[model samples]
Target: MRKTIWKSMILSTLAVGSFAFPVPASAAVQVNPVPGLRQDFIKGADVSMLPEMEKNGAVFYDVDGTKMDELQIMKNHGVNWIRVRIWNDPKYGVLGGGGYTDEQRALELAKRAKAIGLKVLVDLHYSDGWADPGQQYTPHAWKNDSPQKLEQDVYDFTRKIVQDFRQQGTLPDMMQIGNEVKNGMLWPVGKLPAKDGGKAFFRLMASGLKAVRDLDPDHKIKLMIHLPDGGDNDVYRKFFDMLVKDNGVNDFDVIGFSYYPFWHGSLQDLQKNLDDVSARYGKEVVVAETAYGFTTDNYDQEKNHYGPAEARRSGFTATVQGQASGLRGVMSDLAAVPDGRGLGLFYWEPDWYAVPGAGWKAGSGNNWENLSMFDQNGKALDSWDVFRDVSDETAPVVPVTVTEMDEPEAEGSTGIPVKLPQSVLVTFSDEHQEMLPIVWKDSAPVYDKDGDYSVSGSVEKIDAPISCDVTIKPKANLLQNGDFESLSLDGWTVTGDKWTAQPTSGKGDAKGEGSLHYWGGTPYQFTMSQEVMGLTPGKYTVQVSAQGKEDSSKFCLFLIGDNGEKKTAEISTTGWNQWRTVKIADVEIKNGKAVVGVDMKGAPDKWGSVDNFKLYRQEDSKAAK
Candidate 1:
């Protein structure tokens, strides 16, 4: 599930909207034949909100306004699998405000999915609400249990849940023991870096695994261990190494990941991580949750979570064509996994249209409306054709070429520009009336002097080799240890009550080993600053990644003058689990000296951290004598 700080907050009243319910279709109605992809590959979606939507009188309509069964529509469009999340004893009833994912609802949905000949994957959140990397609150009933007791509880709860599903003839085809267990599940007890070197965490997870194995004696269900951010290779390496190699608790059959292109890295990063993990662990990899926007337009009153700007950053246009293209690229990457370990992908909540009472929370209608395969009006989009039309055999092939451009003088050069190929050609095995468009980037390479260097790039929307080799020189970063890659605060000074150099708990700077954490206990303030001094004065650009635990906490990145005057840019701590970059442009560095750092003022219950500090002198600035 997507992480949000306000996930548990509830609205006092539900929004009012009109709904038209159509006559229920018979469960035995025959559907179209299953659309085959690569051999045994899974094309799936998570329709956890379907039950709630139906209960609220929401209805699905085809493009012609004909009412249709949601599951049958998905099966006709090539989706063979369905995922449902289960929450343990939610505060709200099964269809209540905050917790709609209770066991009974999940089982009901699972049975309905199975009735449509679709496989089911059960996601065990083990919490009343969302359980992600940011917050993994233990279920209220198990909050006070001892570690040993908690382990037993996990086993007992999992066994009972599986047994219940079996008795109902709706056992999940695949099961996720935990949802996004990147930082460990169930909070402090089962969380990472435990007092005994994560032994307790592994033991807790082991109990859950044992329950799944014992319950499914015939090995009918495949088990999965899920983590967030499928693009982070280091995280996968660190996490699985501890769980499998070091601890010897490798019982899961599949490795599941959540890959949201905007939050995670680029497609290249996703491919690399998937390849590495599949080869190293020899486990089938599945993108358990992924989605792309087809439009930035807000059709409903509720705010659309992804806008045009974010969709563009993801290298795909916020249009139907772009969504289709994005899925094609993703499928291509997954198909390329070594030894065919790539099982497939599941579009997260693609049916979450902007219907009445179908929103993630009360009063707010479908924040992910733009990402749904169906438009806000409940009409299927062109993106749905991606599943029916594009297959491994008929996939579009895109070929790219990169050629070097003549290098100019290196004097005062900040970035080197490379010429792009005149045109990238796309071809398909069968003839097509139109050509598929492509999205690509030609990044400016850093050139310090006139020498040989290498630069990388990527192309999206088709299956193709996206990398090319270019020659250039490299430029030097003025601030030493700017990214904290050295694992020490060698060139930084702390002027406050509390600061520590440590590996960040959540997603840190895109590339780094450590970050400066400021624990300014209640009502305190601290600053971690680094000064770069020399002769040659000019304009510089300062950029840093900083975040805080709470909204009240303040985190600011500043450029300090020699006389102590500071030019600061405030950083928003809204998405504490995600990193946001703060850039101070055109900062004048008179006397060739300035202090660049982050200042954090701690709130009563919050702290802040900063990392990936970078200072670059503008090449266009006048040179100092």
Candidate 2:
């Protein structure tokens, strides 16, 4: 669930905050340097879309408005390494277009990095498109290959790639065998948690490792094993333990973690996991990928991946300064790694600013412009100063105290528990500050009656206690048992096979204590519905948390009014346990009675789970229309 390259790139096409000219250079934030920063620390960027972007009229400029090559601009701003993704055959993509990360494109980027004196890290996805914890469809050409044949193909294909790089005089400085192989790669044959899947995955990984080693007998290029969920120590421990002790396939130079603060966890969680895994496996740890949004504007029909909710989780605002602080926090965490086992980090796709005619595929919008290091006009943002200032090693800003820190506050409907901020921004005596995690006395506070409540909390670095003020208004949800905490569908009308209730303690996609689960040895279609009576007639919206394994299955959240009015919102799932919220909004409730539920038509051997069905008045709902 780390990411989908295609989906992330297909953002929004509409221009936002456009200007007749570039922003002034003075608009960038200038910061003092970090103390004792390492000279060889990896300040990297994954600008794989540079070729496509430039080809489609994208122009890069410095803070001073001087036009320059994107790679050159990155190098000037302290980026010393470039990461490029290589797809086997993008022409076979499901979208029926040439994938942008083919060998030629990757090699071109590598050459550009080399020309600018920057090191290169080659990321091999193995598949023709995106490969992550969720989906890992094998390359179409190798679809019919057996395990033995697949192993041979991996070796041959990898060897040829390395050879091509060597011939071009742009051999990558480091190579990742596979991209984010947390749940393993190459689909069912190598999918993890299965009976024999681990063995098959190890074999395939070993084959790729052999190719890199053979091509680099001198061992000039470092090798790495990359995975998602950087803050989850258990995931790292189990995966590495199995690879090292059980299968004996631990021949790698680095352990790479893709940690996006919002998706992974707090900065404290990241530091703890990095410290543990680096010590446990005795390998160098590098944050392979990370990024934060500088703004929340969606600009078009495409919704941004990072917003207020994600920002709150990280204890940072969606602002230019917030973006800088987030990256600085990451750098500080890595710097604190014991024995200097922590290497450095790479910002994913910093150059992928929104522009017409350039996206993940033809006619697709860019959903990640808010997270780009460049603005809509390709002007370098003030946050880029973090890299420049850190690399310069000018001076350090000391934090003396947090007397001027801001208190936390939020509001929510009575039925649902108000989500307190996980972290808080602490301003110090010198006015230099950072966002730190908060340890609350009462972590979960749910109020049945409408009123205001305060939860006391303490910051790890601050001795003084703080309180978060929450305003709980009247309940907005019109239905009951929506969170599935009852461990059964007591209020839901069930159809098809009997479903299982999964507890939150497990790895199921339940956001609360329990969720509705469905799957069997045979194919099936089912519905878990609820009819709510006596609703105030008006525009309404329903939101449900759900995930599934079948990409072809038609899973939808639907609503029907008493007068036969109907509406449906399709749920698009990336993987079995990677949950996402799906909602049908702006339903005019002409009658007092309305029925809503999940209707799933799953294929044989496929599975899915759902939880947290909430019905809110249209004005109170946050779901995109």
Candidate 3:
């Protein structure tokens, strides 16, 4: 979701609550009251490819064009923590394929991060390759082991890794027992809904947790259980509920989630989910993996994974400005968590530039080059500004009370003025001198054709910025079966050979019975169009949730006018497995009938799908102006 950072001046009356104090035994005694402060928000990055990029002749430079050590550069950008991932045994073993994050390689990286006074977060995949919601393969050596033996192996391996770090005096400050294990880990033995009575999954996780606790006798290392899809509260609630209540496993310090905006949901949804999970579990939460593309243009001949298409789907342009804005939105959301239970965030692989010989697998050069904080040329991008101005120490004290005294009034007639809240009285203690008053800057006016209209005010404080959300209920959707939950292409007219109804994959719509999948055919052409009639539209927005299979494919949403004119908005394939919203705004539907649909072309090897095609007729309002 696109967010605006508003700056406004505030004039407010201060109301202070009176308190009675009891005298201490010694009037001259100096005492420090308990600090009513949140933990220092962590700003971190996963530069697992730092060593490989540096070794492959990639030189990093600061914004001023002066060359510096990469670690120092990150440190200079307000980065206080670094994360490194470790695979059990890569295909070519440790130090092969540009040091593919084996145990030793991870330790080296951790030591380097520590050398610069950066805390380390260790991510253990427990597999040879990637381990996520879709796939979590067991190590080759333990693939054939029995359930009991695999649990033992998990304990042994975790303990050994922790021991190695402890002996080197570089134990990680935080350790993720598993990386994005949404479906559980260790494949068949410990997979979710475990065939063997669901005990194996918890046993494996318990083993890992025990190993961390046992190896670090001092209990300095914080343990985190990570899962992907940070916006899905159901996934987190169900998984953790099962793990803790049903499976009897509940010893973890932090709840980590991977939240790539394109793949996940909007920033608002993420904020809601984080708030719910934090309040429900009463545990610290962190966005373990997040990144935005700086540019859609490829810097190297090697196929870039996150290109222009991916950037569009990410709801941000593939520009340095977009990267900074996206990161700012994410960080702001993380910091807005109620009671400050939101710990912080980590940008995944911010240093993985498109350097030769530094690829995920053999010949698959850096797919995440565009998402790095540094440019393809190894020059730091403007995104580092997110880390430059660290202000955790300066956050204003929480307000005691901020109440909306009066609701805004808007007349139904045209040219009628709608009165909105001008200011709010803020109550705070005398110590909170730096706390600024809340001011109304702008508001989103919601208007429905059915005569339901409301306005949401946007407020902001300069010093300690926080989101002030005003709920506005939206109008009903104009299009039928927008979610495609009927399991049939009842309203859509499918053209070309590849459009078919299939089960929805990835995230986006709760009613996931079916979706329209369009595979690029031999001639590379496909379209799914739906006609919506009976609409008096001045302006409308066409939105669809979609995902693609490869970066080369183009998925577009178009509004076809009655006279053959078309307004189109398209997103290139990005996070193909993760669903994202594609929206075309301000579409002037002159005629009552307009054809709304998606078109797929180019890159026959790739396929794309869409669901939840919604059309909303925007009401003419003064607030919208």
Candidate 4:
């Protein structure tokens, strides 16, 4: 079932979503044999998003009973609980940031959650900023401390935070000691794996968990030890085995899983992992954090994006319909896990939609709006309310007990179509193709003409999520020998402040394709002084693109200031890949070199290939000056 997809480099064609859009076959006639099914049920979304609702004037529980709010709408749709993440003193990054869950906001939202009769689960990430597998920098105040001090801080913070919530009458129904702590957290002193310098990882975890117990004492709290997205059995196995041995394993209650279908493996893998976890650890499982973007385009260019599916999924389709349907399927599968052991799952922050000031990364804002449950304007999306069992606003709830079926089969009475799922198998014939010609699609990632090989998407470049394939295969077709295929923009330089464009690995950036035309040193380098010309008195911006194996290097888009001073806009190219676009901005003037490109690192090397250069002048006069 090969479908026609538009493939291109991008200027601006982003929508929030999960996978490549499976070319819709006009008829429902089968193209291939569908795989086994997951007859799972759903519990609903995390009600923690209600605070955003209140802040937005969208009522969760109307004191005066004014009108139906998203919370009521959610409950009516079958959502039973709201999960809130509690961070310690996250005034700057977590608490004050828009859209992200902060402590104060969490309390506000928790009150709304309780008011709505929604069970609340308090997730505590010891750090004030985002905590995940990749990087878990310690909290600022705790940074300059000994391992013992850090340990006490972790315990005290968890204890006091939980105690405060309890005192406020909004104690979380359950509490997660730390957020996705696979690699361990609160660095420098309490880091996990005890690697680098933080030699007290396990002890650090103990300190925190102990604190939770100290505060509660009753042991009623359902403690959770969350790891990264589920589906990676090897990673989890290693992590769990280490925890059991080093941390003694009894510190937590529930096994927290964060499953994102696109990044993680298939539902089959997920089920297998869950069963394995429950069987191996003898603990209950809860999908602590889970979500799927309604679209792939960045709704707000100023903030955060989950990295659109197009930029990540070139092997299978990452579409809104697919993600939603996948969510339904995931829920259903979890329901069927042994012993109702699959308790429930929470849709991570379904209320995080588009808002004027909501963003994640600094400088760029609102780039992830399309990926949120809401649009850029903060309005809810139809997709946001989607639930397999109780999506319909007018749908009647089938009682948990039925006279005929014995158990609760009330959901069967409803006509909610079972979201048919297509299992993506890594088969021989359909081996993940690296050929861009076969892989590219008609999307933001595929920024060019539909089904055509696009050289560059646009000149006035804005950051867009990039999606492509890997260059693992050793073989290539003619032209020149190379091992990788990379995203290259046209007018952009090979190296600049924003990125370090690298050479194809003696081959194209992507596999199956020959050595790319402008990939390596053979691909001419667009140097400074020769690239930029016009300038004005206002600020101007030019986004730089970089890709490939060679990551570290210096590059910049330079401009001569009115004082004849040489100023350059440098974007951090610390972590460059073929799948993202970085922006560059600096003041410009009517002079020489308004936008110049230069490789600051004098050492000769193939950094990366940059193309689709975009120039945005603050004032229109700058464009003409």
The numbered model that scores best in lDDT is 2
Predicted candidate 1 versus true structure: per-residue lDDT over 526-565, tens digit per residue:
7778776652466778898766565666678899866677
Question: Candidate 3 overall Cα lDDT vs. reference?
Answer: 0.67
Could you list the CA RMSD of all candidates, in the order they appear? 13.4, 12.1, 13.2, 17.3
Mind giving the per-residue lDDT tens digits that candidate 3 earns over 1-625? 1123222332333422111011134321111111222356778998877776777798999877989888888888778899998888887233355347788888898888888899999998888877776568898889889989998999999999999998888989999999898778888787886566567888899999999998776779989999888888888998888888787788888999898865576677788888998888878899999988877666666655454334434545566655755665566677777888878899998888888888766565676788888877888875685564335334222222222222223222222122232433222211111212344444323333324444444335423233333322233355645665533344467666432223232233222745665543233666778876655546777888876675665668898766678999976656555778878877776666678988776564566567778776667432344
Per-residue lDDT of 516-605 in model 4, one digit per residue for the tens? 222222122345332433232356555445444344444555544455666665534333344345555556455433434444452334
Ranking by lDDT: 2, 1, 3, 4
Q: Model 1, which residues run further than 4 Å from truth? A: 1-37, 92-95, 392-554, 560-625
Per-candidate local distance difference test: 0.67, 0.74, 0.67, 0.49
Query: Where does candidate 2 stray beyond 4 Å?
Result: 1-27, 94-99, 400-625
Model 1: residue 232 alpha-carbon error in angstroms: 0.3
- Per-model TM-score, in order, reads 0.66, 0.69, 0.62, 0.58
- Tens-place lDDT per residue, model 2, 230-300, is 98888899999988888999778899999997668777889999999999988988999999878866643
Highest TM-score: give the candidate number. Answer: 2
